[model samples]
Each structure stands twice: as structure tokens, then as C-alpha cells.
Target: MTAITNKGSGPIIQEIAAVIVENKAYLSEIDGKIGDGDHGVNMAKGFGRASDRISAEDTLTDAMQTLSDVLMAEIGGSMGPLYGMMFSDMADHLEDTDQIDAAVFGAMLRAGLEGVQEIGSASVGDKTLLDTFVPALEAYDSALAGGADFAAALDAMKAAAATGRDSTIDMVAKIGRSARLGERSRGVLDAGATSCCMILTGFADGIKTRLT
Candidate 1:
């Protein structure tokens, strides 16, 4: 029966931004192995800016919209548009919700994934963020379906996200600049998947903290 109010949950997005900002170097390091090394720098810049725009008066939807706007318009790279659409879709799904329960949260996650798939060509095993994202959402949905509570479902999601991120390490890149590396890319983590894990876990932790 526990849920988190949309109101005052803007800080959850802020927390996500903070985590991205703090991990900028690590993300870039991973990216540098197979692609451009600017993943962290760009992600940190956009997320930090979004954090500044987030206000206490903003609801969860409002905060997500602000972040979506920044990522779509300001950041450069394929990630910008992909993540922009993801957040935009999530915010749209949650726009009228006063409380986020497991079902609502699942809808939001599915919406985000749909939005990303609409604009992205990557799929599971492509050595992209979808590797982490697809499994995380599925795990969350399965947990809810199996009679787990909201917090427990979130735990499932976070754990699945991490596992998915780790899975990317052995995968050969099938898209993006990394694809050119072929077998060379197999030993390193996909930067996008790593970042996706961070974002999903941040969301899980933030929502768990706000459960009422």
C-alpha cells in the first residue's frame, strides 16, 4: 500500500542528477576505452544544469520535464536525444498522478523505454544502454507481478540494472563508435549501460526514501 507522493519528489530527480554529476569521470573513463571520452563530461554538464533548474516547488513530473528539456536541447551526442525522450515520456506518463505506486511506476518505466526505442536503433546485446534498461524494467515488472511490494520491486530493478550493466562488459559492440572496435570492445563496460545503471539505481533509492 505504500506509495510516494509526486509532490516534493523533485528531489529524487535532483538526486539522480547529483549521482551523474559525481560519476562524470568514471563514465568518461569507460567511454574512452571504446569511444569518445566525453560521455561523462557531457552527461555531467547537462545533469548539473538540470539540477540547478530543479526547484522545491516542482513536482516529480515537472522536474523530469526540465531535465528532458535540457538533455534534448543542450547536450550533444546520440545519448542526448535518447535520454531526452526517455525522461520526457516518463514525465508525460506521470503528469496527472498524485502518487506513484508500483503499477504507476511500471507504466512510467515502460513509457520511458518505449520512447527510447522510438528514436534509437539499439537493442539488447547491442552493447548499449538498452541492455541495462530492458532487464531492469522487466525485473521490476516481474517482481510486482510476483507479489512483491513497491520497495521490493525497486530493489529488484536496481539489482537487475547492475547485473545488466555488468553483462555489457563481455558483449561486442554492435552499434555506435564502439562497434568499430569489434573484439577490442569486449573487455570494457559500455559507458551508456554503466550510466543507465547509475540512473536506475538512483531512481530506486530516491523513491524508496520517499515512500509513504
Candidate 2:
């Protein structure tokens, strides 16, 4: 009911990992309606392992790399590679920054999206995670361009993500197994986009306490 607040990525990542753990069963229940039903379990296991690997001495890249490694090795199903690619690409782009500003952070998200594009070949409106991710990243960029502060930009990004997630309910799935359902997919929200929004929104909410 309240706004998502965030600070740095470290504690937030840990919180995200925790969220995955807490919601694993619920996520699977949603996925069962339209997907393989293993998405929730895979995501939770991946993030939980990554959390144990993160540390205060670690950088964002380090945290992301740890996430990538865990997901790539341990996570199963299509969601593994897709989520892993995003975090890995984000880490690759962020190697140069110790602390990211709003613009820089937005660009990092762009890099992550590009990774997803490279792997999934899906774009916005295709009813994939990109539907939520691309819009959220773009919203972050737009808000920063409009002279909004970090918190404001993050707020816009989170809002756009929620909207994008909701939009999927009206769209016919254009890729993956759900696409096979044709018009039936129109009324059901995309599990991938919903989960992606949850991750991003969780970061925004958790960072409020950690960022200075």
C-alpha cells in the first residue's frame, strides 16, 4: 500500500532473495495455471543461493555475478536462463562504477534488457518479461530526463512495471508455450512479467533503508 523505498543494491538483493523464498509456492501456483509450474521454485532456489554468496565487501557486479552463477548452474527451466542473462548483463555493464547515479543506473538496466533481447529475442508487447522490464527501465530514464531525483525515478520505474505487468492480461502471448493457447492467454497475466515486476519493486522497497 505504501511506496517502495530503496538505497543500495546489496541489502535489497538480499531482501529480493528472501521474497523469492517466501513466495516460491505462490509463484508456482500462478505458473501452474499457464506455465511449467517450476518457475517459483527455480527462482527461489537461485536467489537464495545467491544471497548466501553476497557480502558487504562485494560490489554490485559481484552480487550480480554470484546471482548469474547460481542461476546458471542450479536453476532449471526457461526462467533460469532468462533471469540469469539479465543479471549477468547488468553486472557486465556495471563493472566500471562503484556507485551508480540515476542516469548510470538506468543505462545499466538498458544493458540488462539488451541481454534479455539477445537471449529471448522478445520485445515489448510480445507478452514476455520484457513487457514489464523495458517499460520500467524506460520510465526510469524518462523520469531522470525530466529532472526527477533517484527516489522519484525509481518510483516511476516501479509504477511502470506494475502497469506493464497488468497489461499482459490483455495481450495474447506472442512467445513461449503460453502462445500456443492463442486467445486464451489474453485474459491471463504473464507470470514472467509479474515476477520481473516483483523483483524490481522489491528492490525499490528495500533500498529505502540501505541507501544514504
Would you list the clashing residue pairs of candidate 1? Answer: none
Q: For candidate 1, write residues 60-144 as lDDT tens digits.
A: 9999999999999999698899999999999999997999988999999999999999999998999999999999999999999
Q: Which stretches of candidate 1 lie over 4 Å from their true place?
A: none
Local error of candidate 2 at residue 78 (angstroms): 1.3
RMSD of candidate 1 to true structure, Å? 0.7
- Per-candidate local distance difference test: 0.94, 0.80
Once model 2 is optimally superposed onto the true structure by TM-score, how far is the C-alpha of residue 124 displaced, in angstroms?
Answer: 1.4
Residue-by-residue lDDT tens digits, candidate 2, 86-164: 8899888978575666666777788888888898877789888998998898898888889887878889999999999
Assess candidate 1 and give its TM-score to the true structure: 0.98
Q: Give candidates' CA RMSD values in order.
A: 0.7, 3.4
User: What value does the lDDT take at residue 174 in candidate 1?
Assistant: 98
How much does candidate 2 score in TM-score? 0.91
